[model samples]
Target chain A: MRRGFPVWAVYALGFVPAVVAFGGGLAGTTGPDPIRALEQTLGLWALRFLLAALCVTPLRRFFGVNLLRYRRALGLLCFYYASLHLLAFIGLDHSFDWAEITREILKRPYAFIGMACLLLLIPLAATSSNAMIKRLGAKNWTRLHRLVYPAALLAAAHFIFAVKSWPLEPLLYAGAAVALLAARLAPKRRPSLEQPHEA
Target chain B: MLIRVGTDLPIASSEITPRSLWLRRRDFLGAGAALGLGLTGVARAASPYSTDEKPNSRADITGYNNFYEFGTDKSDPAAKAGRLKTKPWTLRIDGLVDKPADYALEDFLKPFSTEERIYRMRCVEGWSMVIPWLGFPLAEAIKRAQPQASARYVAFETLVRPEEMPGQRSFPRIIPWPYREGLRLDEAMHPLTILATGLYGEPLPNQNGAPLRLVVPWKYGFKGIKSIVRMTLVAEQPKTSWNMIAPDEYGFFANVNPEVDHPRWSQATERRIGEGGLFAKRRPTLMFNGYESVASLYSGMDLRANF
Candidate 1:
């Protein structure tokens, strides 16, 4: 029931997983392969945040819940996690062997899909600032942000492919992503009497 | 608990390995009570090659497994392999051998004495674990058969009971059922190759191959076929399950060589399970999983080509 959810709160919550992963790593509690576990955790959070960012529009349209202020924070957090996921693969797994990393990106479908999703997110992250948003004009900025939909789908694909077998957790994330995207396609209904009309 | 050792005490090199120390901590504590009596040294000196790396925790080892018969998910084997009937198992040794026979699991193991071997298990997926296995050398079993001179390869096969193995019953089976693996005759006869029947000083868990399994220390884990039902000495290189399914990805000689990368990923480094944190750096993979003794087996052959 809290209105105007603070953007700083979203950011603080966003970093909780990172802190837990770091603490667990230091304590040697992450289990036999901490690097792989950390990589998976980061990638999963990236997908969750991306899906959460996509949920904002549908939530406002259908449920009359306004979380527009925190949408940028969620999107940025998604990008942050995505970056860490890639870093874990390249730095920890590959040991900065650029040749091997490039080979993996080209040869592995999951890696290619993940890299593509991150690449698409880079422009969105760059244009997130108010100054760039104003410079690009409202219509172009809105159009550019639409890329989030495809990026989310790519991320879901990456998650599915990354696992040796298709597990339920990744499938559930993919299903949620599809449902959110489908909700955007639904026809907008007339404003309810209880809801305030946007000027 | 801490034990002060005198300078004159002759400690086995294996006792110093991180994995041996960590895994034998309980035993070590008990032995610490009688440290000056040299009882602990006698017990520790028995192992042939115990690496310095610590074996993964029992929880990690038992909880995470890759027995595809139960299912493909790492946890699935632990959850479902309990259904397997390991007691009434029989192993068949035949083909190009002086004696072709089927022996009950217990009867087959009666002739040989089991020894504890701590080895590094490197999965083709680029994850690795140090395990202490209880079994006798594969050479002993092969010697019993008296393989013919013409025999050039050894083929291994796992049980294919879809009724018990849910993964085999899965529609659109992932890998071919009745999983198969093979090794060159020389590789099979090597002292490092073992037919493990127990692990961690206990009867092997159902998920960890139950009654019997192969433990080829220097090869990728898949080469160490589990839940084995048949082993045949053949005149030609036998077709292996992984090699048949994805010939390009998995080759006949699936040695743990960092130089040859899997089609999907690099094998230069591997995540050592139960060690570093989630964000911890991966350890660089060692050739033949650090078993330099087996290097002579592949002399003059291109590992990358074989891979």
Candidate 2:
């Protein structure tokens, strides 16, 4: 109970958005262009998860909100949604046309950055388990997981270019990502004795 | 009047639309103020250029749109466009035209005879729809204005009421507001270029550009600027809203060319809305959006470069 909400509930809440996005999409409730709508909705959820996971640190630092136990769950959810976003693009948007998909990935900077972001996440997501962390040692695992910062940045870039215009929603998401990351640069006190972080 | 079948508005059921079909559509209008319109009850002629293809459902047509003045998302307009009051609207036509006046919306639409024109609309975002637009040719108004020889281009502008249009008030400006679009004089005078007042045999839904919108079938859908407030005939080519925003991605001409891809997305194929559900293959896009009769307009020019 001291840990607040259970980690499994974090996962359950995550699946709710996935179900709503893909389920609403497949059922044609999202509108006429359900494939594109679903693709974007999944991508939006991924960004939200990445931002939420990144928030765990700042909330602990400033607001004294300890959501550390669920950080792994949030990060893993980001990976799941990111993969779904790509699946929608490939399976629905491009229909598994490897040649066309490859050409688009090479040609558009957004596609290139989006693919690169998912590739970068693969290693972090793979190593998220406690057993893998134990094998890699705490110091190395922390360093490797730091890849999330760049992943967040790349995810924001992919969203901006994909939108094609600098609309407020994408820009607001981008601003939040940058601000959450920049919060790390703020002067800090010594880490709490209960939850020691990377030195 | 140099009126002949311009292109691709193929002679599909040129006779009057059946009264029973109009009665069937009456149930579909759903509280829209179309019944009050004088254009109602007058049997509209089927366009010689009208397409035989089934038009998209009114729900799909209105529910999904890109009236950036309302918002950026496809569904944003449908949700937010209710704030716009289509009543007491004014249209200002000036610049190199014989008659330059700020005419009321009704007076502006008074002269032309209305008909139903079905056009295949292709979006720059790689989606397409077949829309049955109820309006008259823009050429009819252009002829009435009697453009001077200096009028090489015709520019149009959308209304910019920030109170009604939430998008106009957005900080950092998603698009430079009072969205503007233009067409070459010949393109404007072409019989296919229509000033659409309504669609689906009812008043145009606010989301789908209520009151007034342009329909240049040969060009991309963005060129069909909505809720038009101004028309200017100028000597030099005008700056369009999208072209002004991103010069490389959106060019001035913006003709529907499968060969000329957008900087981010392929234009070679487009998913037709309401055709097939989620897993269906996208249909191949056509040059000039399959309106081949207008090809002569760009005979010597390069579409790829103009794109």
RMSD of each: 7.2, 6.9
Model 1 lDDT tens row, B1-307: 2211111224422345554454665476457656665565545454666565667677777877888788777788989998898767889999999998998776787788777788899999888888878788899999999999999999999999988899888754667778999999899889889988777766788898877899998999999899999999999899998888778888999999998888767788887877645444577899999999999999999998998
Query: Lowest-lDDT window of 10 residues in candidate 1 chain B?
Result: B1-10
True contacts kept of 2: 0.63
Best-matching candidate per lDDT: 2
In model 2, state the lDDT of residue B104. 82
- The weakest ten consecutive residues by lDDT in model 2 chain B span B1-10
How does chain A of every candidate compare to the true chain A by TM-score? 0.93, 0.93
Model 2 pairs whose backbones collide: B9-B48, B9-B49, B9-B50, B10-B49
lDDT of 2 by residue, A82-105 (tens): 999999999999899999999999
DockQ value of candidate 1: 0.32
True lDDT of residue B183, candidate 2:
95
Model 2 ranges with Cα > 4 A deviation? A1-3, A191-199, B1-45
lDDT by residue (A38-127, candidate 1, tens digit) is: 788889899999999999998888777778888999999999999998998888766788987898899888899999999999999999
- Real contacts recovered, all predictions: 0.50, 0.63
Residue-wise C-alpha lDDT for candidate 2, range B1-307, written one tens digit per residue: 2211211232323234553575344344333335555443444335788887778888889989998888788889999999899887899999999989898887787677578889999999999999988888999888888899889999999998999999898776878878999999999989999999767656678898878899999899999999999999999999999999999999999999999999988899999998767776888999999999999999999888888
CAPRI verdict on model 2? medium
